[model samples]
Target: MRGAPTAAALTDRLTAQLRRRPVRAFWTALGLYAAVWWLAAVLTQLNLPLDAVEMLTWGREWQLAYWKHPPLPAWVLDLLYRLGGGSHAVLYLASPLFVALTFWAAWRLAGRILPAPLAALAVLPLVGIVYYGFTSPEFNHNVVQYPFFALLPLLLHRALAGTPASRGVAGRGPAGWSAVGRERDWLLLGLVGGLAVYAKYSTAPLLLAVALLLLCHPAGWRALAKRGPWLALGVFLLVAAPHAVALWTIDFLPLGTPAMRAAQAAGWVERLWYPAWFVAGQLVNCLGALLVLAALALPGRSEAGLGNPRSALGFDRFFVLWMLGLPLAIVLAYSLLAGQELETMWGAPYFALLGLAGLLLLPRAPSRRGLFAALGLAVLLVLAGLAGYLGKNLFEPLTSGRGMRAQFPGPALARALEAEWAQLSGGAPLPTLVGSFWLAGNAAAYGEQRPPVFIEGRPERSPWVDPAALAETGALLLWREDEAGRPPGWLAAWQGSLCPQGELVLAWQSWIELPPVRVAWATYGGRHCDRPPLAAR
Candidate 1:
């Protein structure tokens, strides 16, 4: 039998493996991260996050536009809905998968720009980023943009470096890729860049940044001079053209949302205050990353180039400024100029390339020890986030008798509502509902019928719920229980004939000991509601 390896030998073997196959280690880490977070999220969160639940309400409509955003996110959610056979829990996995894809894109980008082991060193610091960690479980349009943001830069970099006359030039496209391959990269850049905005209109800043890069930067200027940019623009228009159709068909319905006004500058002071507040949130979010950089750069350490990686070169310098800085500058400037108070989460995708940026700050690649230090800090940060997540999500419900939306008793609520609807509708399929996205959405998502919610009872918000269509099909009218358990003024107007109504007090899911959920509900055009099972009161 072979003798057991020495500790030094084992260490060397592991190091060699990481050197040879960092991608494997990268994937293994992501897998573990996803698995742990998924289990924890499932355990702590009985109901979906608000955005996710809201997406479900939108997805069933299969519309090209929702009131708040574009269709790509809804399209993805709709696909997941069908794949899960209507199980909303499947979305719990999407955020993780999207996050992994973002990380993978970053890794791919690093490889294209930097040499191997050094490339692996830079990516480890990303573990410290809050956007990629604590908030990742809640898949939304922001989460969907994760991969798009990372991949777009990667594709653009390849295209810019691969244009004609870039052959054997510094920062040229990866070796062995022919001119055709470079052209293909441009096509992909256009496709992905277009889809980024399709995923969210907020992605326009990045697109604008790309345009500026082409206009001003050397590599980008060269690429623009060739067939690459034209081809890219053509493909971009082709990919994004449908959204224009979607907008026209919808008559620009998003302009009608009150939330649009809500996000705008409320007062003259808000221009300064809003951007400052947003910047502050982003800084706070990136502190974990800062810590990783600090660890990687501790002075007097044996780390190969801990505090000093090689300075970024020609295109790399441009990439940092335009790709990283310009998009953010555009957003802040717009917020300042237009008085639009930006959501801080809009900053999430901007930092996926942070590790690549780190190389520029440090003079040389960090030694393996330094890389490990950064990775270890990341692991600690993730654990801290987990503890915080569980504590907030669980401790409040157990200790203070308060429940977050994550702790909502959705399945229990759905089951009770479904059974009651069956009796009331006499098996008519419980066609639809109108209420708050959270309340009605939970009911529809888990209910066997899976009816679409007409959010806030507005055709503009839920355009699929045309009053004419609903008049033919009929819908359930429901809302959360106010202190007085009263209907809204709109619903109370009673334009349509109604049936008997009742309340549903849903027991908490799993071991959550909080007070049950209470929704005031009624049948507008369904069957039997006289003998209600849910509303004992």
Candidate 2:
């Protein structure tokens, strides 16, 4: 009885503290969670994933836009490297950092609609979801869009709620219409929208969803008729003007490349099932979080909380449904009509509001016990994901011959390539690596000089490379091969014809279980010191 009383006292104390400082507690948990993942990354020395490598390669130049995606993620990566000394640890933190921003945004948005404790509860399930934790190590465009998705909902709620006091009492009238004409709200909305689009084209779904919701709802249609929507549009155009120009300059190459066009040509069966496959994958991805939430929620309680669909006060529920449902519907419809192969991961950023959706599905609010349970489960799942990531990077290769990219001996290969380059070029520093993105990117990252990487031997994809300067400084034309063998047919022919005298084979061992991974490398123009300044190109 004494022990039980002491435990109760301690629990009460914690409950009091949590009540007093909910926001602080939320942030502290987020920071600790991020630290755990970052430590795992550092300890394992995890190699950057393929997309991350491409991001790093693209980020090195700080271009207006990369060949594949928008420029913000690359810009953020470049900024992180500049700020944190370009270490791999710094690169790995990009995803966690963005995810935390998303969590904060979600918490803020939830606070708008729910009590502080319930807001925290709503965010717990989201953090448990695999999209935010397990698959977030790779800081791709999808991860980059998370914060924006969270922010869009938050801003949209505030704008639609029309709190005139928040917007400086712009023609105060009814609560719903008070801030409809406020220039500040429109401008902010437009700014966030433009930035979201600048991050990824996938953000268009949220944007389209918001526009369609407004057109369908009477109040929203009235608000849209005001100057707010027009102002927002003008601001979006102004903010997006540079990217529009960049797109035009590049002849809209990012829009529909050969790969995308090929995807659009998928057979009818594939197209018909793609939506179903996407839905199934999403369910699988969120299964862990769903289980945790189910444990927290009451048994057999399944109902949409909003009653009376025609009530004016039901706008908030309608807003949630529109935001969550319409985007999904659009994706499903597009896949069905276009006959395109849709990767399930493309839905990564679209699910940030899943916790709120989960809340709507419940019959009642979660109790304190349920909240703590959900949070505990989420933390465990995150740690499990982190452990799996570490195992993949540090342990898997020791037992299996299958080489993981994370275990690749980038530094070893880089050193060997540098030595061969020095011998071939007579002391000239390797200025570039021309090969497939992964091979060259690994070498570029780990090599002493940190040379620029030209993706797929193409200069346009690598804007940093000046063709004339690359010719003057020379590049190591490199490609992977089967265990100390020669380059593939095309690469071998290219090497044999272009740099016959400079051929070199590198026996790079990424793991002991497997045979040494070989790279065929050839030097091009390092013979001349008349190269352009490294900084200039």
TM-score to true structure, per model = 0.89, 0.85
Rate residue 229 of model 1 by lDDT. 84
| Candidate 1: regions farther than 4 A off | 1-15, 163-174, 178-181, 255-269, 300-308, 469-472, 493-496, 510-512, 526-537
* Model 2 agreement with the true structure over 305-387: per-residue lDDT tens digits: 21211222245566666787788788788778877667888888887777766665665655445544555677678778887
Q: Model 2 segments beyond 4 Å from truth? A: 1-18, 163-182, 257-269, 299-313, 419-427, 483-486, 489-493, 500-513, 526-537
Taking every candidate in turn, the Cα RMSD to the unseen true structure, in Å, is 3.9, 5.7
Ten-residue region with minimum lDDT total, candidate 2: 303-312
Q: Look at candidate 2 and give me any clashing residue pairs.
A: 474-525
Candidate 1 residue-wise lDDT, 286-334, digit = tens: 8888888877676534443222345334556557556778888888898
Name the best candidate (by TM-score).
1
lDDT of 2: 0.70
